[model samples]
Target: METTATIRGEIVTFLQNRSMTINQFARISGINSGTLSNILNGHRPMSMHQLDRITDGMGLEEGYFYDLYIPECIFHTTPDWRRLGPFLLRCAELGKLGCLHRAARMTLENISYAPMLFDMAEALFNEDKHEAAALLYESVAECEKFQYSERLALCQYRLFVIGLGENQDENLQAAVYFEPYIDRLDDMYQLDAYVKLINVNISLQRWDKIVALGKRMGHKAKIHYQQNRYRFRTYEYPRKSVIFYILYSYLIQASMHQEQGDYDNAFYYVSLYEHPDWINKPNEEELLIIEQFKDWAEANRYMYGLMSGQPNALNQYVDYVDSREDEIFLALCNIMIAANRYQLHIDHILDRYKEHLVFKTQQNQLGKISDLVTLNRYTRLLAELGIYYLNSKQFDRGLAYILDSLEYSIRTKSDNGMLRCMGIFEQFRHFSSEETQRRYTELIQDVQKLSVYAWSPQV
Candidate 1:
């Protein structure tokens, strides 16, 4: 019953070199002397906790024995979840991805372990250890690739969310990849998935895609709401209330229509979400959602009227949004777009909210949903302001705004935003000073470099 020679020999050598007794080492490592004796004699398996303490007592670097522990303690025999689970969790916490991958791959050799890995991945995901979680999720997903299971769909969904970031092109790819699996997900998740997909599409300014997704989301939400309204309603629900999705679907559709310049249709969809009287026995949560949407509808009505060239709409929209500080940023963005479109001057309005024009994320009831959408609108606002100033023949101010827009586009990796900025700068290049022109060239070069890097093949 000799211990695995490699790890045991290392420990023996360390003790010999330091003239340390087993009892001394045990005292230092906080392990019971008998347990250490058993571990050294191969009478007991070395748990991850014991291994960590042993490594520390030897004055070695953290996780120094992890690679050795895998074969000596884990893969040398059948992998036990009691040992493997805590081991993987420790790996995630310590950012020991190499060891995590090695252990995970060994355990996943049997597809029966997929569920265990998947559950651990979910735990890691909730703990915000995304990279480690992604490894498990990918491993589990690959194991279940040919199967049409809800777990597989959930893995894909997790991967989709993990993959999303500042890169617009990458976000679109993730959305497209996760789209088909949406139907395979349980009812609770599909609405949130649709909402996330729609947000990505909104950043890309894919109005048609948003419209299509919104319709599907609305339909699914309506069906679920009706089917479950009279039931006990004890089951787990989506992040938002059920009716929130339906109302959100309508709100998004109206916004998409507004973006497309179909003001009449936009107003029609706005009205659909405005009242929401069809909600059966509305709870406090549902009532809050309805109220929020109503406020949005009211503001949007002013936005639509202003965008469609109604003379009186500008003052009213400004007054409404001014009273609601949370709405100021997005409301001003819409106002600028309208002013640019209709050749209306908003100098007074801009001066009034000049302090609010900076890019800080505004919090809303629905987490993360408004952050990205607000960012997209803010970027567009920058470009619109540039255009407005240029049209007014304010060369320095106009180029300043344009440069800011280009910088933000580059930061966000928004290809569409970058292109728009490039086009706008090119249109006004003749009016730009030498300093502004040089800055523009530098930004364009950065864009080109990013483009090349994005298209480069991974080794």
Candidate 2:
């Protein structure tokens, strides 16, 4: 006779319809009879676990009771973090995103819940539960939108990182959205944020943005380093050593300048990172950072020389990169570019490192290389190879490599990469076979579809 449209009423109706007793339902649900009685009679709030059990006992899909439970158990009463926190976590664990979103939305009405939600989001993010954490981060950010708190900035930062993926456009958008919040974060966070921001922009080939951000990061890191040099605060530190940021800033500045074909300025910045003689007493970690930067500097020195058409630098660059597994792909890429530009014969060099020409993941002492960085380099590598072969009058190899790059470009939604591939293919259309032309046509259609997809409003 319970006519109310509530979870307990639904349970009552179900039991009556099946002619099942409370004890029978308890046995089926594996919940204690006494506990089940309290849950049904509204004497006690049901936990997510018990609700799931009851749902299963009712022969309903998992989370069948989540919608009712939210309004009835959570929204109808004062929100308690003790109960709400576990429920949200369980929802995440069960992949019940709709319920999690609803519960978070309801709970965040009180701005006091923002801190708790942020803390929960941090926990979820650390646990690598990114999708669930993103919901909480979005909710918390909305709740704290009017505030200029570091927590708000942190949320934006986390969202930026979580949002990064194969889609270059979305990654760029995420970076732009989060860039304004960088100054609001603490110094340590700013350093880490700049590095991540730079990495994404690098993937997108935004050299100008990288140079600007790198300068800011370098200034902030230098300030922090000067202030904290003698102080001993082991508890607080950046994601990397402070020295890493300083050197990385110089490295990126040099890289951007080099990309812009300013080899003189590039070499100037390169010298700054290569020499760390200013450090009074370098530790093991600091020494390691210095060594790494020195290696990078050496390779880059040769690259700058070779890129500026220094004939002797080519052999040195090849010799250096040949011994380093991590350096091989990028070195080969730049070498190919140089070879094409200078009309240098590097057929032997190509034959030597041909095995490493494909896209792959790599790990170093730092960690797994950024997928964004890897993908960007791989696409560019393919395009460069295509251009190299085409310029060498190897038409079939050239078209095949170009088409492969174009396909990857479409898959990753890299507009610049796609355009580069398309332009390169069009330049040598007369050399393309019928099959190659067909593939190119199909890839162009895919690009058109991708453009439409990007512009279409999400439902």
Candidate 3:
């Protein structure tokens, strides 16, 4: 919702902060003073060339001014889809979500452009420009009144998929948006929607809902498989889509049981996925997916074992997946194993994986990773590392990790994660030196002020 005037004002403030006058800035930027004054005073629009020169004059990075100027450009430009569409697409190609957001806000009153916006949104989504796509989709959804229109449904579905690994609230919103259209969707879309809803419920720890949905999905998959089997060749009854839904259902049930501390049921559900009959039934692609699911489920089972203090769980888990090459999965498994074993050698392990973790955390903050599950895992890993370092008496390093995690959690609007990090700070405060305690107390207060989510310890 920012305007050209706001951007110019920011530039003016930036120059003033550096104790530079507009004339000095214009001189250094190689721009005419009159033109600079006109642009600054809102009498003239700043060209990209002028903005770039000004950025250079201020010692800012390339594209710094361009990024700021994109909103102004889009806002002032006429609303012809033919002209605006390519410009928006170019911004997306350049990974400028801010520009897309600004354009969406600017075009909010122009519903006639919603179709073109939807197309551009899809293009952005296809290019993995999720935040940009989400912004446009949101605009489209608003224009469509979030009705059962195909575009609305598609927007809701994309938003749901994108939020799956990144934002629980977005996931919840997408789930609500898709609710009325679930029955009207085709089989594949319906199953996909159910899978996403189940994942969202899992992140929210809505166990009862997970169980209900899981059972329903299981039933649907069973019927789907049976009907297709009678109409098709051997092992082709359940297509890969149906197989995925069934596997995901099993995974959800396993997770739900694990959360409830029912390891037996958790193991039972995982066994269903690994059972010989189910294993022998999948097609090639389905088999690969099933194998991945098995590995993931096995990791969860091992995690449960470690949490429950079962003997040799860490060693068993290490021996099981020691050869795996998936960096994120291995990093997570290693951290959990180290934490469970009370290994104070967390510093070396963190040093080894910190960059990757930080990158993923940043991606989550930037809305690059839409999978809430993955985002949560990465956040939890950082928090656990923070806690481990604190327990190891490495206060500074621990605080750094905790603060980093807190920042990411806040950016993602993750109440659970923010509260967890805050709790860590509180616990650390009680055991720290006076100076450290004061710093931690201040941090705790800041976190409390920033946490807008309504959360209670009982919840």
Candidate 4:
């Protein structure tokens, strides 16, 4: 679209009318002398920042620029406000975002009615919109003032994205501008801001700075980032520069990719967000990434697990099931046994992942007996029951769990699983009386002497 060169140059003209010299004006207006000279001489860009500073340092209503030009050729002209909007909308539906953007930029540069100009810009935005959404977004800002600051700033922030291209730099500026209204902004928008800030700083290669900024931003930045750590393993960035894009680009990319079910890139970009730069920044949309990853992983694992069971890859799938199912089972056992829900947890273990339970039918668990699956579901249940007894202040019962878990863990050579048993062993000693602890400890060394396993059925 068109740059605001005329409006910017106008600011230089406004400054020139003042009696202050270049040095004096620079000092008073707090604008850079170099920039001011360029603006006055028509050699530089005029920015909204310049307009704002000029408005503040000088007594100009900012609307004065609008009034100076009688017809107000700032955004759109032709008084075709009504038709162009709908016409532009039609063009956009037919795939003409660029045309819409040009028309909108022209409107902003030509029209006196600021809202009309915004409409024209929005029109351009709506046309063949995806490529130029950011441009349209930036066009939302109007030179005219809105009475409510929050509404005005939000409008401006959106327009800033459109006009400037949604790159990190532009979004960062937008974020800072809307910062005062930050507390009142929605959580998703806040996350967008923090993500933009982090991304901009990273592109600038200011990681060291992000370390502190991340902490300062708090949960708005971190919750999703941290939770997705495990989920991102499947994602691959493939390159570096792909990490940073303007706000418009990021949104467009995210929206378009979502339709394709292509999550790797989205997750990768979010991983960049999870870095020291964005971690802990609290924002509402924060959960979107993690939730998305969880959904993806859950679906992927199930699909892969099913495929893994094919005769073509049964052994491989068995290995796959071995690696994951055991860990999940152990964690479940730990959580449920500690909570005294062993029976309920047992049903969960059996109903789900039953195919992965490779043991035979004779070992006793869940009201049945199983004989062959040596280190299978039955053994785990036994271990968990021991843990439940232990967790419930029953040292003898806890010792029984450790011993059962030990038997299974030993047969399986699951060192990790053994570590869990050792943990309970320590818990028993910590909670039990010294005399009882010593006896259980001795029993642990000689499991054959235990009375519970010495059961002789009287039929």
In order of appearance, the predictions have TM-scores of: 0.95, 0.95, 0.60, 0.27
Which ten contiguous residues of candidate 3 have the minimum total lDDT?
361-370
lDDT of 4 by residue, 373-411 (tens): 223444566666676656555667567656666666545
Candidate 3 local lDDT, 169-286, one digit each (tens): 6666766666665555555566656666776776666789888888888788777766674343444222344666677778778877877778899899888876536444566666
In terms of TM-score, which candidate is stronger, 1 or 3? Answer: 1
Q: Write the per-residue lDDT of candidate 2 for residues 1-459, one digit (tens) a residue.
A: 543589999999999999999999999999999998998888998877788888898899887777778889887876788778888998888899899999999998788888888899999999999999999999998988999999989999999989999988889889999999999987767888888899899888887898999999988888888988776547554877788899999999999889889999999999999997777577777888888899999999999999999979999999998778888888988898898889888889989888998888965555677889888888888888888888889999988999999998998898888888888888899988898899889989999999898899999
Candidate 3, residue 154: the lDDT equals: 71
Q: How many backbone overlaps does candidate 3 show?
A: 8
Name the lDDT value of residue 320 in candidate 4. Answer: 41
lDDT, candidates in the order shown? 0.87, 0.88, 0.67, 0.45
RMSD of 4: 24.8
Give the Cα error of residue 200 in candidate 1, in Å. Answer: 0.8
Give the per-residue lDDT of model 1 (tens digit) for 1-459.
555557777998888999999999999999999999998888889888898899898889888888787888888866788888999998999899999988898888888889899999999999999999999998999889999999999999999999988777788889999999999999988998898889888888888889899899999999998888876556565888889889888888888777778888998998899988898888887788888888988998998899889999999999898778788888888888888888998899999999888988786544444466777878888999999999999978988898899998998888778888899888888888899989998998999999899899999
For all predictions, the C-alpha RMSD in Å is 2.6, 2.3, 10.5, 24.8
Q: Where does candidate 2 stray beyond 4 Å?
A: 1-4, 231-237, 454-459
Residue pairs clashing in model 3 are 164-371, 164-372, 165-370, 165-371, 165-372, 166-370, 166-371, 166-372
